[model samples]
Target: MLKLLALCLLTSLMYVQIAEAGIRYYKWEVKYEYKSPDCYKKLAITINGRTPGPTILAQKGDTVIVEVKNSLMLENLAIHWHGIRQIGSPWGDGTEGVTQCPIFPGDSFKYEFKVDN
Candidate 1:
């Protein structure tokens, strides 16, 4: 709670350029399905009906808006940007219990963050 507050304060005091460059919107559906990447069929999480998911195209300083819908009947969903920094939007950081909470089943969460260095 304190960390969230401090992050919010720092972002507000600093220059926030989210959406200053441009805004890119994307809608993704999260669900579980049967997939085989190594010739073995197993249950796997797929985004938009794909195992690896779709590619997100963006440049530096651009704001990415992704609305993710969790279709899993008995699971929670949280998207963590592997190497991207969560700038100006820490609530959407997607670190589960750390930065944000999990999106419950049949629920949705909109992640809005800027692509920073």
Candidate 2:
């Protein structure tokens, strides 16, 4: 009986550890100072610094913090978390001229928002 009880306690602790795991790091790079062939005008742009960003395992009520580092020549960048509710989370939405301005080149910004039900 003692052994069974000990096993159950260990299992419970492991489950909790898995559930509270932090968010995975995702890296991205936005490029500027380039004109499109058709447009012939330099504008804002984005490219995955590391191809295929890692898939983050997130759950409801989990606080997500996406650390973005801009290394462009000219122009700032921000991430707009789509499909996620931003009722009180304007920073994470990453809406230029709305929620928050883009981060300048060589600058870093940490977007924090909680996923709630």
Candidate 3:
């Protein structure tokens, strides 16, 4: 029993180490919202109902996975990485209608890419 307990503890430690080394994930929900960003109220595309959305904080050589859910009732949604260059994954280069099509309303799409320096 003691030996088994030690093995389990060691396995949990290794798992924690691997998880902290790399592999970051973010979940976002895209929807239309009306709010004042510049002191005026207008319809805007937001992630998780926030204007700017969530920011991804990761280091080079780390893997990032962002699962975006489109909640708009009448519009389609797509996300672009903007400036972050992908090293190996070219399909996720952030092109509209190219990265496996746009995420339709009430649908979910996962965008995964590796951070490159």
The residue-by-residue lDDT of candidate 1 on 16-116, one tens digit each, is 55435688899999999999989999999999999899989888877799999999999888999888888778888789999999999999999998887
Question: lDDT of candidate 2 vs native?
Answer: 0.70
Per-residue error for 72 in candidate 3, Å, reads 1.2
Give the distance in Å from residue 15's predicted Cα in candidate 2 to where it truly belongs. 8.5
Off by over 4 Å in 2: 1-48, 51-54
lDDT tens digits, residue span 7-83, model 3: 99999999986676588999999888898988999999898889788888987768899998999999877787888
Error of 1 at 95 (Å): 0.5
Looking at model 1, residue 16 earns an lDDT score of 55
RMSD, candidate 1, Å = 11.9
lDDT of each: 0.89, 0.70, 0.83
Q: Per-residue CA lDDT of candidate 2, range 10-42, in tens? A: 999999976875564555555544446466654
**Top TM-score model:** 1
What is candidate 2's CA lDDT for residue 26? 53
Please list the residue runs of candidate 1 whose C-alpha ends up more than 4 Å from where it truly belongs after superposition: 1-20
Clashes of 2: 0
